[model samples]
Target: MASCTNWAAHKLVHAWLLAALLVTLLTLSPSLSAPACGVLATVEHPVEAGRPLRLLVVGDWGRKGRYNQSRVAQQMGKVAEAMNNIDFVVSTGDNFLDDGLASVDDRAFHESFVDVYTAESLRKQWYLVLGNHDYRGDVLAQIDPALRSIDSRFFCMRSFVVKAGTVDFFFVDTTPFQLKYWTDPGEDHYDWREVAPREAYIEHLLETRRYNYLDTLGIRLNSGSATELTWKVAVGHHTMRSVSAHGDTQELLQLLLPVLKDNGVDLYINGHDHCLEHISSRDSPIQYLTSGAGSKAWRGIFQPNEDKLEFFYDGQGFMSLEVDAGLAHAVFYDIDGQALHNRSLSKSNRQHVDQAPSLVSQE
Candidate 1:
């Protein structure tokens, strides 16, 4: 009996050691390691044949339907219905206010997103990037694959690419570029799980010339045999150029801006400021568009910047982009479903032709 008991104990010890070794090997394996910054996940969104691609962009609004979040969503739904056959929605982060999701099962996710944008027309896939506010909480929870089970529309990632016909939208993770979030976080806690060693991460993401991970995206623009013009749009949570409360994210301007410009990115859409704005870059053809007026917005918080402020509105609103083979139209609508500003850009001329804000007759 004593010998049998000792044998059982030895077997148990051996099993424990084997399990520990397996876990360590799995953790150390490069295949099981965290995704490299250069490897941006790509998702293909099919655009209807012979139809223009339409998408709504909203940001900085996860306040549980408060601060006109519901209102904006309602307006979005109305606009989406009117447009008909909308492709998808692009959320510029700040999906949750104060902090991000506590976990994948956090009720706030359903309350702020699922319940708010309940329009049948607004039930398309939502591609999202991470904002500074989103990094304060459980960052992994926001991008967890499990959230899709709760709501299929919930799609968030640190950085990814959305390919739709002639357009390729490069959604970049800009929160890690900000130095203050690391050195002087004040009272806020940032979840930098996969983004430690900031220099290596950013370098891999924006590497040009040698590896040319992101820059090569432009090459594919003219690769096909069709005569359709290809468009490149860069989306992020921080502003590379702005004339609002968070006037300009210096870190992004210094690091990300050059890469975008070099890569022939036509538009840089972001939403850090709590307002809707459009600024044309002085040096490049890239247009800076902000549609952050999803929830609370600053009343009179405007600052001077070098770029041309094409339009600025300090009220709650959302923006829409309609793109076809040759032209792209962008419009900003106020809370009451009125068009505050609209612009049309042609692929041939690439000129910014501003149109007067026309009112959308209410239903």
Candidate 2:
């Protein structure tokens, strides 16, 4: 039985296939992997000071509303405008509410993302990570197109090293491993409470290897970026240490921090705690930030021995990070452009030695 729609689809598909075959036959050559679009804008400290590489980091903001998401976007755009430009944007996760908007294709993407992020300069550099909400919602297809359309180079659950002048950033996908949830056969979302009717487990399937941050991406982490590079940062969608109703994320921290510390990662940016807190690790200068204020204006509650916190704020805003070699500066602002928090990190051992002989001294 050949249905009219099926016949029509078949003819269309056949025509496309014929064209592909013809092209292939005419061009008998090997194919190459898609070129890796360099992750967000990367550069080193020695870059021209006249033009600083600017970036805004925000997360958990897919829900479109007034108190937070809307206000935050407005303020972020204002800052980007003042600077005359922006390099890229990083999202820690929770791109949407409840269940990641049914799918990445949901109308919410336009309202929450497209409308809010109308800054033309920002379109090219948006790095996104899947939050728990995205996982719960069946948005695999929708998510891909939205992100790709936004920034084809935008990555999810993958690692891409970006060189900001002289620093390297290794971004990871921590949400998938945090916990696996399943939805019923026809459900668009997984119930946080009830497990899916059918549950199956696949062991050692690569991405599931939580510690792979040190294994697969290990090379990137241990690249001796030490002194050659001014700074190295690790970004994810979950928190390492936070004090809020959402509380501390011990499971993720325990598994991830050691790798970061050992790899000379100076800063950790994440979104999930729904607040902002820049904490200094007692054992290390590595900075931990919580900027889950995309839609959630949740407050922060300092933890025990939390004095290392240089700045903490609960506002609807995003963080603008500037890194120059070993020195990095961060400012979190409110909807009115008022600075809510500011923090900076400089390498105590700041020196530039020519590791590559093929270099010329600017001086």
Candidate 3:
């Protein structure tokens, strides 16, 4: 009888200890508990004068809070907090999932964007562009100000320019450049309701008159001369160069590369390959960066373009950038908030030599 009583007491003590541990863990910061939102990672860097722009770039993240989306958001929150003064977030399209939001009031909007990225640091303005997936749904709703009424952080347009300090960011609408979307949508349903009859849109984009001679001036030159344009960055949803399964975008290369080259653009940031990558061209000053690993990732889909490819990772993550007057610093972090790659470039290092460039080569 005494042995039975002692065993019962021991079991009770064990249960109490287990419960205490659980409570302690739950009480800690959400990030410390596990991969979750609302947790802030502590990072401190002294702000240098003349290099005031700081931004976070993410893409293809809308998965309705699943597929590591929440975890990635959590890490972004932490990074944002640590790296203070993040001016804004660049959404490289595919902001919505599979088919995109059905309407301005679509449930997916809240489920994927609002509820998923509920971190204090993520409250900044979100400059967004449409992805090919976004075309599969109501594309107008995304660019409408109605979304801003829902959450003031949302900002979307077909193409526009934003000037922050000495730098000029050119946001380009790239989904229309793909000929396949026009010729063969296949099993996918693309809601071309707003800008249907693909040929017209492409013609207008390519036409110097309809495009306001913008194409002739070159998108990069729009930023002005070196004295005025310290940094020129081009952001788009499609990639002109990549080594992933999607490979290189032929349309973008033909239409966009010349403009980038002519204008002496510093970096071309895109998110279509669904991974993180950096490709440095020996022939041009422009560096290619891919930050499509917002949530879903293509495991082992790398094709390894060894000539220009610098860094490539097939996983879920995002990229952070800090631009100063003389230097541009880039870092890629995984879902766990771990830094994967870091590279910096001096303003004097900007190359503009003309040569037929190869795509991202494998390491």
Top TM-score hit: 1
In the range 1-363, model 1's lDDT, one tens digit per residue, is 234335334323222112222223322313222322223445677898898889999999999999999999998999998887689999998999989989988899989999999999999989898899999999878877677788888777666667788788888777878989988999999987755655554454455232233443344333352243778888999988877888899987876687778766788999989899999999888899998889999668888799999999988999999888777889999888888888888777667765634323445
TM-score of each: 0.84, 0.72, 0.79
Candidate 1 lDDT score relative to the true structure: 0.77
Where does candidate 3 stray beyond 4 Å? 1-51, 201-220, 223-229, 351-363
Query: Model 2, residue 314: displacement in angstroms?
Result: 2.4
Model 2 residue 294 lDDT score = 75
User: Per-residue lDDT for 126-243 in model 3, tens only?
Assistant: 8887899988888767766677778877877666556565566777778877889878889988766535555544554566232322352352355233464368788889987888
For 174-227, candidate 2 gives per-residue lDDT tens digits of: 654455334222444542321112211113223344222344355555545446
* CA shift of 344, model 3, Å: 0.2
TM-score of 1: 0.84
Could you list the CA RMSD of all candidates, in the order they appear? 10.3, 11.2, 20.3
